[model samples]
Target chain A: MSSLGSKWKPVIVMVINDRKLRFGQIAARIHVISRKVLTDQLREMVEDGLLIREEFKELPPRVEYTLTEKGLALLPILNLLEDWERNYETKEVLAEA
Target chain B: MSSLGSKWKPVIVMVINDRKLRFGQIAARIHVISRKVLTDQLREMVEDGLLIREEFKELPPRVEYTLTEKGLALLPILNLLEDWERNYETKEVLAEA
Candidate 1:
């Protein structure tokens, strides 16, 4: 969990969770992130066993990124976080009135 | 979740999740962490609204840290991560044989 401390790591994971994407597609989807930083984050995620990187031999030598089983497993936790904010946090604030 | 990326943040949260603890107690539980870094992490957690810090007036000037509702809300996610490692990640490895 501590391994996910970077600001963009979760966002990057969320973007790539359902579909395998090329590096350029990921960068464009998360355009606020710098190319170098996005590259670093992807590399780290791969090292952490949360992502898989595949290279296809073609005229362009395409590379794609996909979430591994370990990575897909994180989606439940992310959904719980969003639900916490939506249900618990917001409800508490409204109650404080 | 990304905010919890530090090596010590998750450990610290686990220590404080069950009961409120003084600074010394928390520091002692996660003893491998340096004092300065522990202090910094605790401060950041407070600022992030994940922790509530209370200071008592006394000759000894005591302070205690507790997880707020927001912080407590993170437990499910953390538990899911643990379950994922124990169940999914390990199962996949065992199956790939």
Candidate 2:
């Protein structure tokens, strides 16, 4: 919980679980976050040793990001948070039920 | 997890569990935090409907803060996070422990 991640960090990690993704692809997954913030957060994650960045010398400058082992290690915690939110935080449950 | 809390939110909430506390008290609990930042974060938590702030118009301008129902409901999530941080994220444990 004291990690260097914003509110969308768990969501981003959850989406990219067990896979690598491009910058734009990651941005597209979390709607409405500015390119700057996502990029900044991703860079921070990299610095924090939670992500691995691979750069390729291609026509459009191919770049891919993937979670390191430590990052993958966080999946269970994210799952716990998601479960807590769905079961408690989200305003979807019926009062009668 | 997606709640409007920073690194110290769970720490703060955990410290004040089931108890109402004053502004200075909270600031004191978390070391090295600027009074301004603590005040700002607490105000944001209140705005997020996770905390209740009571202001006493006394000679010293006393103020007390307590978690609302929504805030207290988040205890379990915070507890899970603390557990995760202890068993996983934090830089503790002996090598090969």
Best candidate according to DockQ:
1
* Model 2 deviation from native, Cα RMSD in Å: 3.9
Docking tier of model 2: it is acceptable
TM-scores for all candidates: the values are 0.83, 0.74
**Local error of candidate 2 at residue A94 (angstroms):** 7.5
Q: Evaluate chain B of model 2: give its TM-score.
A: 0.84
lDDT of model 1, residue A41: 94
User: Which ranges of candidate 1 are over 4 A from the true structure?
Assistant: A2-5, A86-97, B1-7, B88-97
lDDT of 2 by residue, B1-97 (tens): 6564377666667767789999888887887788888888887888666789999999989999998777787787677666656665444344336
lDDT of 1 by residue, A1-97 (tens): 4546676777888889779999999999989899999999999999778899999999889999999877887877777766765675566578778
Clashing pairs in 1: A5-B5
DockQ of 2: 0.39
